[model samples]
Target: MRTNTFLFTVLVISIPYSLSADSFTFFNYYHDHMVLQKSSTGTTIWGQSSKVNDVVHIQIDNKEVAQTTVSSHHIWEAKFTSPSDNTPHTVSAVSSLGTIHISDVLFGDVWVCSGQSNMEFNLHGVLNATAEFADSANYPNIRFLHVHRQYSASPLTDIDSVDAVWNTPSEKSLSSFSAVCWLYGKYLSQHFNYPIGLVETNWGGTRIEAWSSPDAVRRCAAFGRKRNQYSQSQLYNAMIYPLLRNTIKGVIWYQGESNAAHAYKYSCQFLEMIMDWRTKFNTASLGTTSSSFPFGFVQLAPWREGEANLGFPQLRWSQTSNIGYVPNGLMQNVFMAVAMDLPDFQSPYGNIHPRYKHEVAYRLYLGALGVAYHETDVDFEGPFPTSARIDKSTSILTVEYDRGLHPIEVRSYNGFEVCCVNQTTTFCNAFDSHWINVTMTSHSFASISLDVSSCSHGNHVTQVRYAWRESPCAFKQCAVYGKMNNLPGPPFTYYVH
Candidate 1:
């Protein structure tokens, strides 16, 4: 009987011992070749451990950053002061279980590029992709952390996919990398001469609602039906929430194709998504105020079927008009990269995925240079019409733009259109014969004279729109450039009294 008791006791002891043998380790994000955010404070290094109350020491480049004990929950975290210089460093996390050493880590700006298929469009599919793949070896400092596509019923602490890891830019790595992100990173790295880290979290053909939190989606009454249509908060819970601990410079989004059906509600939904992310990220990382980081997004490119139904234009207007909805403090940090001129024109009907990703990336890079980097001499935004007035006697309409204007490439301005209140039809009179001579009065104003006498109705012109059509390409002629950077102007619309 005593021998039997001894064996049973041994079995009991071994059971708990075996369970405790699980080793402590760093999160998947903290891996070799990872680039931490430079020129910023409050960068965190975190992981999980099986041992409780055990100290975890973090060292960067042989210098100690901090030492913290693993909590009862088996999680450990430590924040380190980021070095001001851009250089490669090795980080080591030592615990009772073992020592995890991350090598070739870089200190530089890190950005999160998230959206649908366009953002997920791989570099391998882009034009001149072969040349780009061969040339990728030139920029070793640019690193990419690609998050595998995932969805969960509840928020997960970490993703389980093996492909999610930081990778140095190379021919092999470039194959799966986002094309727009690669171009943006290349430009920033070349211009700034520093390391640039990109966190790619996107799924092809996914809607903005799919990426948004359930709470955020529920807050908008317009999305009530949509909330029940799919698994609410699946993507946000699985993909985005896990990265809340990561410190980033900003986010560049290229979505809106899926949300075109609900174009009217997009303004509020998009705003809420931005605010929700900003609030959650800031609160999780720094416990600071909302709207703490910058956000830049690409306005939807013109699609073939969308033009016939006028869906793309409505979505574009929704995106542009909501820029002011975000608080003023954060509004200045918000940027919209226009793609009205970047769509594929060679096709009888334009393709949704434009071949010219370089132009898209260039536009985004210019915005980042001005907003995030604070380059004083960069002209990121095109001419935006601020105000307009009508002279009833001469039947002349003068519109004032924000950025200084120049003469359009073509003498004829094809984008300008007019609408009269008395018109029975809702459609604006587009490319009408009434529009005579359009002239640039100064560096900031344009004048358009209309022949009201030719109108069937005697009502004065109540609205004027430039490049506001579904497949708007007319502004290509009036591509005004800023003197600082010489980038072309974006399309605009004006309401007249």
Candidate 2:
């Protein structure tokens, strides 16, 4: 068996325990040629090989596309992620020694999830512990590649993997994989039944900056505002850049608890990361042309509620505000499914890690189905309302949605605190829907349009909101929705919470 003994952690170097790559005990071989997106830059054929420096050649769309060099740590990663004209094409790669050859690679979508403890929370302890789970063993199609986490001050080309492989969910592997990703994958599989791959590159307790590249963040003023976050790109260099050309669906992120304190800046920086990731890959990086690059994410769930010290509500509000700042992109729909509503599931104290992981995965699934699959017929909970405009004369709050079928329904916001424009920015202590329709005085714009049918015939309405002390829209319990079934129900489909 091969082992890597590190001498110093400053550089986070890996020392070889054996000369032969296959001799390593932990990783048998990476399941390769995972995600090949349509119009991807260069096709990447990644996976573990028999030995280090094993030459790999890729053939995609009936053409030879990539060649790779294995790092001394015995890691093999290569990409030819350029997509060609949105056509379905097959890809194949063979090792020089003929030890591995993977065929039938299709160009579709791929996404990577990397962050801190919240992002790293696994499935075992959360919802359905493996002991209680059914036999959900292999989905050879939905490849899962587990990345080894490395922390250092400087940039790194590659990181070593001791254990993990591309396989379907098993009793053994189900526990280690991200509970959120599992749900997302389950949704993807059930929604489209396409081959899904999850490249788990997250680390516990790490900051968001550690996941973003130094160069990408430096371009934005928001990232520059923080001193330490800008200084390091080791994780980015080692993890993200290497996988750029690899075909991936859009991202499904679950992060931001660590950055909750600085909510305003996260709005700007988070948008930057989304744009940067798109720009790094497709020709039309910013919008739907990049297959709409469905960048959905789980809104931060209920945690640290009513805490005197922790700013849980504020953090969640900042998270929900992502819809406002990101512009046009819809919120990744989950919150309810992951059942943060279950009273027993919550920490009940100051705890960031919630036990209800199944609900988290379920919510992610609903999100993937809504965005990536565009399964509008399925009636998934999705595409939350991003903007609500109150029209005085018409007595209608014309609301435009970020996604989903047009002509959406706007209702009372669950969690909101009224901030009166009259006072000196002092917020009122109220548990009411902040955004509501007020009978406009009618001297305003005569052309304003709202979903006029839904509003009451006549009443004095000023604003609308999913109001709570925090910004997330929840009413009955600390969390808005509960139970796995309600996540995809018609009533909870498109609320602002």
| Model 1 per-residue lDDT tens digits across residues 1-497 | 01111111010001111225557777777788888876446577788888889999999877888899987767787877877777778899888788889998988888899998788887876778889988888889999988888876666676545364788877787788889998999999999888899989888767677777765676564442343213456777777877876777889999888877777777767767777787777756553213458788887776653254555667776775533211234254677677776666553223777767787888889888877777888777776666777777666667766656554433334555556555444444433444322443333334334344333355556666665556665324343454444555555556676
Specify the poorest-scoring 10-residue window by lDDT in model 1. Answer: 4-13
TM-score of each: 0.85, 0.63
lDDT of 2 by residue, 352-414 (tens): 676665666666666556556666654445333445555455534543433432222222323
Error of 2 at 336 (Å): 11
lDDT of 1: 0.69
RMSD of 1: 10.1
